[model samples]
Target: MNLGDLAYPDVPTDAVHLLPLGATEPHGPHGPLSTDTIISVGICERAAERLEGEIPVLVLPAVAYGVTRYGSAFAGAVSISEETLRSLVGEIAEAVGALVLVNSHFEPEQVETLRSTGLPLLDLTRRRNAERLTEEFRAGSCHAGRYETSLVLAERPELVHADRMTALEERRVDMPAAIRAGRTDFVAMGMEQAYCGAPGEASAEEGSETFETLATMLVELIREVAA
Candidate 1:
């Protein structure tokens, strides 16, 4: 359900507060601009449903904007600074104990800042490595690519554009090397297309599988942390 349903006049000693952090940015021509937020909220809702009344996970309002520097070259890619994100997360952490942050956009610095709060935090970005799924899908890229495309297709089919799948050749750089140099330098290594992997290969079936696996993993993590 909704946030109003989980309202507690005072401290919600009986339930776990789920703050779903999301982003309102472009996902490419094939996906919606609110793809990140939509996916995050959807996953949180599913997890809440699975847990049922035991945990009483409350769905807080999602943060619609995030630090999306890499995707800035693309249209409709609005982002905030790491400091701002940190402040937002920290404030929320001060009010809650266990937080399941369902993040979609990549912002390592902000996430690190939030993690420093020492509250029970669940970072979904680094939760599950997509290497296995990437190889399994034969997706040449990662961002807005096959995996993401498939995810959107499975989660929100009406948002995907199956007919606009066009192959765009770009140079691929090693992630470890980019990390060593830093994010600014990493931005110079790729095209301005706001994508790296193969979004053309995305399908509803693949999206469904990927999302299901992720949701399952999140459920387990939440239970573990709450215990």
Candidate 2:
């Protein structure tokens, strides 16, 4: 169940509360700025639906801004300070005792900030989890590539500009490698158009499959924490 749809009296205090975390950042010319948030909320919604029959589940309204330093050069790349993000999430977690964070924004600062919250998280950035994702994702070139673009296509096709996506050529940059080398921003990392990877290869079918995998992973994390 979605927490936003319920009244205070109908709220289940004992339910497993999922808080989807993401960022308002530029995805590309083809994708919407809310891509990260949409992907995160989609995973939380799917996980909640799958777990509701087995246990009480509440998908909280997503936190749609994060520590998005990399995309700051791009338009609409709104970000909050790490301290602000940590405090905001920490406050919410305190109010909702049984909380699990479902985050899709993979900026290193964002990931580290969430990790500081000490709550259970569906962190796909971890090697074990990253290995389970699509090839483009694991290659670290999936900023607005097939992996993320496909996800947006599946969750909100109307938001994806098909013409722009099809017209863009593949731009492959090893993001993880660049990060290791101390590249701080998207442009510095060679993402001139504020995107990387292969947008032309995205497909909604692949997105649906990827969502299932992401939801399953979230479900597993919730089960471990809720146990």
Q: Which candidate gets the maximum TM-score versus the true structure?
A: 2
Which ranges in model 1 have alpha carbons more than 4 Å from their true place? 4-13, 124-141, 166-176, 182-187
TM-score versus the correct structure, for each prediction = 0.81, 0.98
Candidate 1 weakest ten by summed lDDT: 132-141
How high is the CA lDDT of each candidate model? 0.65, 0.92
Report clash pairs, candidate 2: none
Assess the local accuracy of residue 194 in candidate 1 as a C-alpha lDDT between 0 and 100.
55
* CA error at residue 25 for candidate 2, angstroms: 0.5
lDDT, candidate 2, 120-212, per-residue tens: 989999999999999999999999899999999999999999999999999989999999999999999999888899999999999999999
Q: For candidate 2, what is the lDDT? A: 0.92
Q: State the local distance difference test value for candidate 1.
A: 0.65
